[model samples]
Target: MPDSLDPSLPRIFLSAGELACPERPSIITTVLGSCVSLCLWDRVRCAGGMNHYALPYPFTADEEPNARYGAWAIEGLYECLLEQGSRPAHLEAKLFGGAALIPAPQAQLDIGGRNVALGLSELRRLGVPLKARRTGGQHGLLLHFRTDTAEVLLRRAGG
Candidate 1:
């Protein structure tokens, strides 16, 4: 893939609690606040995927593991790429989101901080090297991820 994004490439909007691993070239875009998005790709296979997770983990024991949580989202995206013929050793990651957009007292709750921490830890646990990141601020973000090329374009939203 080239540095330029081809206009014909399909575009998909990723929402919180969702993940996408396309078999073909595509552009995945999403907006984020406290939510986090992890973009993973296999350098050798040219395959990639992305996940948007709202929380670091389930708050209760009865909660079923799902993509809405960081742990599950990370693992699910990894598995999806692997199933798409990506090898673990070739995986690289880019972390995004985790902005402290809430006001005052509520901002102190630090869901963004927790999200960033969990994302970093999970990537390490998976043995994926983080190639880049745009995290931690008082504003939201918009991301444009190219699946086949593993290129990301980030814009600070209302910063």
Candidate 2:
């Protein structure tokens, strides 16, 4: 909550299959490789959220849609903003992750590409303009998002 890097400011660490949108000035951070982390911010409300998903699309109807899937995760974040009285048109977006963690044939099962594309498509369909992004390559990422200021700090793993 404080401008300084106060030890008291809550730091939420998103695991491989987690997502959240908080009202307080909490810092959300996560790591990704081939997976995607989509961050959405509402400038008017000074609020933001992020989701970490492993896959771009849901495979079956029988499966319960989860935050681990981009289809659900992306919309879920949008819904949170709307619920907070933030208009869809007023929201800005930033996408991260979708790295080529594996060194195999980059096309056959390029899940990373799918993840980035899916995020971009959904944001476009929602009419939310994507302002920035860091995606693709053969490395994992360390992302820090400040919810209060909607500031993001990113770095490639082991860089």
How does model 1 fare in lDDT? 0.90
User: What residue pairs are clashing in model 2?
Assistant: none
What is the TM-score of candidate 2?
A: 0.93
Runs with alpha carbons beyond 4 Å of true place in candidate 2? 1-7
Model 2 whole-model lDDT (C-alpha atoms) = 0.87
Go through the candidates in order and give the clash count of each. 0, 0
Candidate 1 Cα RMSD (Å)? 2.2
- How accurate locally, in lDDT, is each candidate? 0.90, 0.87
lDDT of 2 by residue, 1-159 (tens): 345435566898998668889988778989989999998999998889899999987788888879888989999989987898889878999999999887767585999999999999999899999999999988999988888777888888888
